[model samples]
Target chain A: MKKTMTRFIPFFIMASFLVTGCNQNIKSTTTAAKPSVSTEAKKDQGPVYKGKVVGKSNKAKQISIEVGKDKDAKTVMVSFDDKTKGLEYAAAGEGAIIAYEMRDGVPFATVIKPKLATLPPGVTVITPTEVKTLIDSNKDFLLVDSRPGNRYSASHLPGAVSIPVCEMQELLQNLPKEKDKLLIFYCGGPT
Target chain B: MSTKSAGQAVKAGYKNIRVMLAGEPAWVKAGYPTYANYGWVCRGNIVLIDLRSAEKDAAARIPRSVSMPFADFADNYDEIPIKAPVVLYSDKDEETTAAMKILHDNGYKKVSLVEGNFLGWKRVGGSLEKGPVVTDVRWKRILAEGEVSVAEFERALADPKVATILDVRTKAEVASGKFPSSQHIPLDELCKDMDQFVCKIRDLQKDEKIYIHCTTGARAEMAYKELKKRDFNAFYLVAEVDCKGNDCSIEE
Candidate 1:
């Protein structure tokens, strides 16, 4: 019965997350578990925890990665220190791969790797200077500023039109009628 | 934002679309003119300078303006902080144009001009003050939160072991030039193969410090988030970088 309850611990934690939202403290009940899992089990040892981070604390040097999927998911609170690798990149709401070891029944993160967002395919990135060059050379392209209206009014690139991303559908008429014309858009640089 | 906007444009039947990821901040940082609306000139946080003669300034000047005569502008331009968002106005078009060039040449990142100058301000019934002005140009640059100081970045550049400089630019951009000691990892590749990247750099532990940079720091910032998410000590430089071979010049 103790082992069966241990298996269901994750489901309870995930249900709590759904109710409490993202901003809440989550604890792992695995604190009392003995250190029977070997650290060298990098392969099918099933020791590596791959999941999305649910919460973290910079001061406490700890992160909670949600392992398993949906109904079976549970938040695993992992503590780290100066010895922990890749601790700088751990953030909540992002996917991460963590390797850990249970010491004194506590899961201590030894390595934390992040899963980053990939840009959508079929898009090419340009620079400010390159856009300027196109403007100076009088290229046959429409330069669009995708920032909010207030920022555009404060200041914007030369010959660029104001087309806020939120209002793109409403301001579709502002774009050139030609479908094949070059359309270059920019906003306040990538955050 | 541009990427999302481009996606919308694509859906709207705009076939050829490209994204300038660096956007307006990068354009202003590259020493280009950004035209300020009349409302911005009246209420925005900016160093509004009357570039006309002292006689013109004392007779009728915009509020929150200092008299910096075009004739002696070269001498007084240095008084304005390089990072100050400067907006200039003068009766003569020639003077305003000349004053903008002077500031841009001197590394003033955010330089702009009031639409239509002083006459335009008055034409729109904008507020003005007369007689001897008391407000002198006063500005000091404060680095944005989390931005790496140029001096500290340079110090790290001089010593490779202290921090690994990660260039997050594309292959074409890197082909032109890069820092001698930077680890080459385009931001797109870093996003897809972060696990492989961590394994590849096994010599440097997860706590190893990495400084990320791109042509205009946009991609560097994006890459910074990725590295930080994985628990790597990372900092991104928010400056315009121009490189020719091994030689590179950074402007903030």
Candidate 2:
């Protein structure tokens, strides 16, 4: 019994060392393993934008990602404010897949976690200037404000219809029947 | 109850609608008085009009009033007397908006509508005259209740030195056009830089009231209240200013 007890002490010390290592998060990619959205959880998030880094305006806290191969590739300009999570470690060209919503024609990244792999979901990002120009021309386009209904009625860009992100799936019914027209969605900036 | 449509009519270039509940027959039976017969034909710089067909105008209308048919109003809107208070009536009280539009477009700032048409005028023991119908109802109410009336505004415009009309629409909206002599200021940018507004409105002229207006009156009202807070003698035109090409006017 004494020999058995003596041997168990060494095993106990080894197990504790492993546990301490895990608590410290000692790994190859050592920044931090933040809470990631699983496949089912991500279903409720806003649209995902996967693309290659085309431009980065660090001062403006903006990034332009190109999401198609060659000529088909479309560039999307994404903006982030102080409240944006996962932005600190998000470097350009790290194969980004951004989950975002637009507000007043500006693309705000709500969840910006890039996959470590190649091509993902790359959508066109409409700029506020472009939207304004379109509005001035009185062109046909769906300007969707993806915020809560109360927030929308309180104050939103003129002509923007309310459609919150949580119920984005239901938007399929409200979308214009004419597929040819432009459909754009926007949300609160980096809240 | 139906004022919403009146406001919308103003937006659509048909301004100043006054609704009458019953016709001239009802008024006469009730022994109500009228403008023509009761020595109430008001004398002032005012354009009284009958918004009826030419045939109807020929049959009966108020004395000293013009016949500008309601349906044809938009086409001949430019001919209204700019400096006069436009008064209007037709077979029904529903046509007041049409008369108001023509008056507004022709730069006649003041507008009033006849609650009783020609029939109502005659029924109210008014003269069964062959002309249009009008009323001093708006003026009386305006003075007493502090309501904004276009007729009052027209009279005010006669003395341009009295008020500085400020156009507070955005550049995009202003690009459509604005009050000819009004100072332009985009309302959204009001607080962004007020020094210029402060500078422009600083000096005093005799009764130099500031009147602000937008395409619609919402922003202008906001700006007016803000300006009023700063102690600048100011008011807002709670009227819809409509424009088609070069033809434009404030529908009240």
Candidate 3:
């Protein structure tokens, strides 16, 4: 029964999301269980993100990817579990594309593939270098650090303040009313 | 409105914006005001623009109102006067919010939606003037406002010390061709990259007039505004400019 519940946990959470609409405080919890039994396991992997694998930690279940090419790159983090694949030969400084899903505001990899990822569209993905340039110039723009509260307060990019994407909906009033304000959102890469 | 609307506005590059507390329906119920007749439209104080299909505009429109379809208005919104009150309307009052927001975002000082829109105008006994629409109403304003004249540019070319020609298009776009002795700083990277932009600022020669231009005039015009906002002596190039290889010409 525990194993059955473990297998259905992500599905149940997703169903709850559909019913409740944008739930905050989603627990980033997962249980180890038997892997998928189906032949379409490859297709079950999630959305793709491509970049250089800057770091890896099997113990913490995290991998960092440097999206964008050359010197203008932004690093992102992705969490993995017993199910994540394609990491056996992944080395630091190698290009990779990761398929992922967000649970409890934390992104987790379903499949790790080898390729340069052009992020799926929502917001324009600008590099950290671009952000550094803006900061260095003293040009005014809102740099939002969309990470957990603890992570943000502990350490964040210069000139960035915490406004986690999970709670961004309710925090509209806190945002700038000025029309010219260029808003930039970033979190731990991929994760 | 969703918080994501803020992200969308930022993506769209708006300078002034406002979110209406109550929608049109509520505003209508309060019955503050919609619009008066076309006589109110033609006071020479307010500019009336029709946001409708060309076919719809060709069928009928208020006298002296310009037919600047929403698509065109969105593309060349910088052409619209930021200081003057712009009254806009579309079929059956649709697109009033969108038009108002676009103008609002572009820093238009005064923006009003035709209360009832096109149908409302007719129902309220406003006359519909048929025939070809006048689209050049804003053209005069676009050139006269802050743009550099061809004569001014010609004089500048004669003396580089008098004015600095800055091209804000992409490196790839300029690799093919550009104006003689013009400084190149790609506009997209200006805010974020600023490798070239910084060089100019640090090497600021405040006395020299800066003439900024892009392929057509939009991005150049925008860059000029940014410089002027920072109190730089910058002028926006409004003329059509074509360049091939190392050769370039500004149209008369």
Top candidate by lDDT: 1
TM-score of chain B of 3: 0.44
Candidate 1 total steric clashes: 11
**Per-model TM-score of chain B:** 0.52, 0.40, 0.44
Off by over 4 Å in 3: A1-191, B1-40, B43-155, B158-162, B170-172, B185-204, B217-230, B238-240, B249-252
Query: Which lDDT tens digits does candidate 2 get at residues B101-128?
Result: 4454455544544435567677876554
User: Would candidate 2 be rated incorrect, acceptable, medium or high by CAPRI criteria?
Assistant: incorrect
Put the candidates in lDDT order, highest first. 1, 3, 2
TM-score for each prediction?
Answer: 0.46, 0.27, 0.32
Please tell me which model should have the higher DockQ, number 1 or number 3.
1
For each of the candidates, give the backbone clash count. 11, 17, 5
Two-chain DockQ for model 2? 0.01
State the lDDT of candidate 1 residue by residue for A1-191, as single tens digits. Answer: 36643653453333212211111122223434212222223443336687767556443345666778668866566777789887654665545668888877667788765432112334444556677899899999988877787777777777778888778665588888999999997776311
| Each model's lDDT | 0.69, 0.49, 0.56
